[model samples]
Target chain A: MNRLFGNRTAIAFLVLPGVAIMVFALIVPIGFSFYFSLTDWAGFGAFNPVGAANYKEILTADPVFWRSLVNALILMAVTIFIQNPVAFALAALLAHISQKASQIFRSIFFVPAVLSVVVITKLWVNIFNPTYGILNKLLRLAGLKSLAVSWLSNPHTALGSVIWIIIWQGFGWALLFYYTGLMTVPKEIEEAAVVDGASWPQTYTRIILPYMFPVISSVIVIDVISSLKQMEMIYLSTDGGPGQLTQFIAVYLYQKAFVASQYGYGNALSILFVVVAVGITVLVQRLFRSEGEIQ
Target chain B: MNALTKTPLFDRSAGKRFGKFALYAFLVVFAILQVFPLLWVFDYSIQKTGDLFGPELIKLPLVPVWHNYARAWVDGKILRYFINSSIVVVSSVLISTVVSFCLAYATTRMVWKLRTLAAGFIGLGMVIPIHTTLLPNFIWFNVFGLINTHVGLIIPYIAFTLSFNTLLFAGQLKTLPRSMEESAFLDGARYPKILASVIAPMAAPAIVTVLVMTFLTNWNEFIMANTYLSTDDLRTLPFSIIRFQGQYSSDYAVQFACMTLVALPPLVLYFFFSRWIMSGATAGAVKG
Candidate 1:
């Protein structure tokens, strides 16, 4: 065993199988995407040499690209600003509850996170169905029949509806992070604050919140990354419909390549998607890093 | 004030009481909000097709229809999808765990020249979006004759999953004292023996984390399954549900029933292993 593994070549051999799989599965394919992006290749047709026409068109003339970007930004904003604070507050509440109650609430909140996205997406689709959806049914029962409308089908409302579903499905996850973060707060810190005449608000603000900086930063970063990569839910529910009001980068790239049959343009879109995702991730990490360093 | 006066005066007790009440109110409201849509699906699944599609705003089926599940299970071809999904998920999980454990061990424990470079190579996998590679992967898999095969799905799944798995395993194994391995060396145990008996047992929690994550991802995967598996009998639960929609249009009961069947296995697994999943997710988050 030592003879086999002690040699540098043997250690490299051990890593080779895994690395080869990744290269074959992901990296080489991406290289193909980059190569294909430079051509006018229909998914199944003869390819013509086009010198960066796909990238040029996507960057300059594509309205759908811009729409997808706008939608992604909107979803990211809603998740970060709206969802995070509410989750933080709920998590704070969970901290004060009895162990049994907290456990029950945690499990209840986490159901959506654990269930398949296919289940949640389909569930919301049925709920938002125009003709037979329960959303309309409930609205009419509440005597708000005039306000009832097709949430997923309307261009004006589609993005918001999609964002709401994403947030709703993900709310439990954010709450779980906060609850776990709060659980780690020492009891003596709270008691010390109280003995020093600091009110609960003050203690939470001055002491507990500061201690949770690391958790907050990590959760926020995860949210940003997940938000940027939002695909399955949007694909299942809207397919970037109602004239692409609900378009997201991930879904848009898929639609471009397969549905629209613009393989080169789709590859360009994908490369751009990677850049944007990495940029946002880095920016979030930088922002959080400074915030942590300042304290 | 009588007994409390012996200690420092605490004014926030009243505020803490308010905070506690507010917390309960918030938890209850959010809990209901979160559970209501799922409950609606549960209730809707049990209603007859005609009864469910009625003009009435909130139609309740007179008879609770359990055959929706029966039809989905016995008739809707869901058993095939479930089996397909199990094969893909289990195979991928095993491959990912073993490969990542070795790679992580090599990077962290073995003294080598290119260890940092190798680790960087693994880390690079995490940054590239999967959607970007789908088209090319299809072409490559086609060339390799892996298209529509279980290997086609499992290989990519394991590849995309290895970085996260490797990172977690490396972090976990790093915490195990090097002295144990050194002592094993003194006692004449081989590297594989130390890895299998000493490191593997201690790394159970990390392994569980990897298993849950890989299982959850494979079970819920849609894009690759959609793109790769073209045959009906080969579909996973997610793809199978899409098929059910296409074939059983307007049969809302059967659709819901199919959805329930697709959902129930994971739900049951989660219920039994909630603690493991929760801890794993949070631990992954922390390390990540």
Candidate 2:
């Protein structure tokens, strides 16, 4: 048993498969991506090395890349600032309500989160259809004829509409996180706060919110990463359409590589994307770290 | 004992009740908003395009057009995509689960020199977005003759998923008593035997959590499946649904029906295992 269990070879064998897969499928590919970012590869046939021209071009000239990053940042901001607070408030209310009602609403809220992205995006795409959508019809019914427009096509509303779909689908998970976090906040803490003459807002702001900071931070981090990686929804709905108004980095990179056949430029964009994503994530962690300590 | 009722600011009973009512109303409205789109899709799945328009947009189908489902399943090639999805999802889930289990076991249970390094390597995989690797993976897969193959898609799925699932398993394994494994070893149960009999059973809940999460993720995964597979026969459900929508852009009922078909399995799974799904999803938040 000692020989069998204590063997380094045995441990190596146990860990090898997962490590190998990650190295082969994940690590090696990123290395190749970095390598390819330097060349003018069209994804096929012969290609010439362009040094950092691809990167230079993307940094200075590519409006689409900038737009994609801006859209992702807007999404991150909306999710953290808008969705998080709303979900947190809803979760707090749900915590205060009856168990049966909370349970029902919890499941209802989570339905969109659990469903396939294709389904959710397509559902909204149809609903946002200008001519025959329920939204436009309802607006016309309410005699607000000017309110209805092509939700996904119009430049003014396209990003907002896409953001709504993303938030709607993602709202439940945020709610779930906050609800679970709120549930674990012991009753005595609130009771103690009340006994100390803390106001309702004061209790939440000074006590409960601080206590739930870890959960909040983690959720925010997840939101930032997810917002940065927004792909399938944008892909299936707008495909970064109406002149790339709703372009996300993930979708734009794919389009550049596969659709436009500019593999090298796509690689450069992806490499930069990776840097930005990692940089933002680390920054968020640090931001939360100092806040957690301060609180 | 209610927190709101006990608050000093809500001195008026009517105000407290009204506040509670308002909260409930807000929650209920949000709940409806979350679910109503899917219900709308369900409604559209059964209605003719003609009925889908006009004031009847909010109305249900007087007689259910059940044939829409059959048409979507048979004519839309959703069945093929379903099979393709299941094959890829099941294979990848099984592979990732087993590999992660082993990796977790080795890292947690054994005293290995490279354990921390191994774990860190796996953990690092999480931060790197899949899109960053897409171009290179496409080029590499094409070079390796894996283009338009399920194996091509499954390899990356397992790679990307291994980090999270392994972490979940390792967390579970750490909480299990080391004494149990030691006693099992003393009883002449070898590493493999101990793993199968001791660790596996103890980690059943974690295993299930990983399995369900992986299933939903693999089921919903679009970008890789879309990028890697070009052949119609190899395309997964999400890819197929997108293709079907593009091709039959005018057929609203069929498109809705096809979406329903593509979405049904995970919805049903969520309905049954909502707790597991919820916990698995929030696991990162709670643990991190």
Candidate 3:
């Protein structure tokens, strides 16, 4: 038994498959991407080495890249600042409700999150259709006929409408996180605050919120990562249309590589996107770490 | 009740009641907002466009059009895509689960010197977005004559899911009592025998959680499946749904039915195993 347990070959066999897949499929591919980023490969043809030219072009000349980054930031901000607060507040309220009602509402709010991105996006696209959309119909029925517009195709509302779909789909997960986190907040802390005559707002602000900071920061980090990687919703709905108003980094890179056949440029864009993603993730972790230490 | 007795009845009671009512209203409104679009899709899938819009312009269908689903399923080629999806999803989930379970068990229970380095390397895989790997993976698969093959898509799925699933399994393994394994070893049980009899059964719940998550993710995965597989017969449910929508752009009811069909399997799976799915998602959130 000891010999069998200590066999190095057996241990290696147990570990190598997963490790090999990770290294080959994940690590090696990224290395290949970096190599491709340095060359002018047309995705399927002979290539030339173009040193740093793609990066420089993306930085100085590409307006779409900048727009994509800005849109991603806007999304991250909306999720963190807008969605998080609403979810937290709702979760707090939910914690006070009856168990049956909470269960029912929890299932309801989570429906969107559970559905496929295709379903969600297509549903919204249909709803925003110019001719038979339920939204425009509802608006006219309410006597606000002047406000009806092609929500996804109109330049002014394309980005907002796309962002709204994303937020709507993601709202349930955020609520679930906050609700779960709030559930873990012990009753004794709230009781202590009440015994000291703390108002409801005061108790939440001073005691409850601080205790849930770990969950809050984790959720925010997840939001930042996800927003930066926002692809499927945009791809299905707008495809970054209305003249690239809804372009995201993920979709933009895919368009460059697959659609436009600019593989090298797409690789360059992806490398840069990765740098920004990792940097922001690290900065967020450090921010939370420092804040956690302070507390 | 005792806590309520400490407060004066006339002090802000009405205001508190109103506030509670407002909170409930807000929650109900948000829930409706979250759920209504899917309901609307279900409504549209079963109704003709003419019936949906008239004097009311928002009425439910008087009679359900069950044929829409049959037409979408047959003409849209959704059944083929369903088989394609099941092939990729089941294979990937099985391979990743077995591999990650072994890796997790080794990392958590064994005393290897390189374990920390291996764990850290795998953890780093979580930070790199899938988009970064897409181009190179495309090229690699194309070079190996794997493009448009289910195996091509399955490889990346296994690779991408290994890190997070391993982390989940490792976390679960940490909570199991070590004495059981130790006692089995005292009886001269080999590693394989002990693992087969003891660890596997004990880790059933965690395996279920991993399976549920991987199933959801692989089933809904779009960009990779869309990119790697180009043939109509090879496309998964998502890419096929997109193609179906593109083809039937004028037939809104059929398109909605296809969307409903594409989304129904996972949604049904979620409804049944929502507890596992929810816990896996939130746990992965905080832990990752």
Any residue pairs clashing in model 1, and if so which?
none
What ordering of candidates by lDDT runs from best to worst?
Answer: 2, 3, 1
In model 1 chain B, which range of ten residues has the least summed lDDT? B1-10
Residue B95 in candidate 2 has what lDDT?
A: 97
* TM-scores of chain B alone in all candidate structures, in the order given: 0.89, 0.91, 0.90
Once fitted onto the true fold, the runs of candidate 1 whose alpha carbons sit more than 4 angstroms away are A1-10, B1-22, B54-62
DockQ of every model listed? 0.53, 0.63, 0.57
Q: Report, for every candidate in turn, its global Cα lDDT versus the true structure.
A: 0.83, 0.87, 0.86
Which regions of candidate 3 are displaced past 4 Å?
A1-7, B1-22, B52-55
Per-model TM against the reference = 0.93, 0.95, 0.94
TM-score sort, best first: 2, 3, 1
| Interface RMSD values, listed in order for every candidate | 2.6, 1.9, 2.3
Give the per-residue Cα lDDT of candidate 3 at A282. 94
**Candidate 2 i-RMS:** 1.9
Q: Residue A166 deviation, candidate 2, in Å?
A: 0.9
For this target, which candidate reaches the highest DockQ against the unseen true structure?
2
Clashing pairs in 2: none
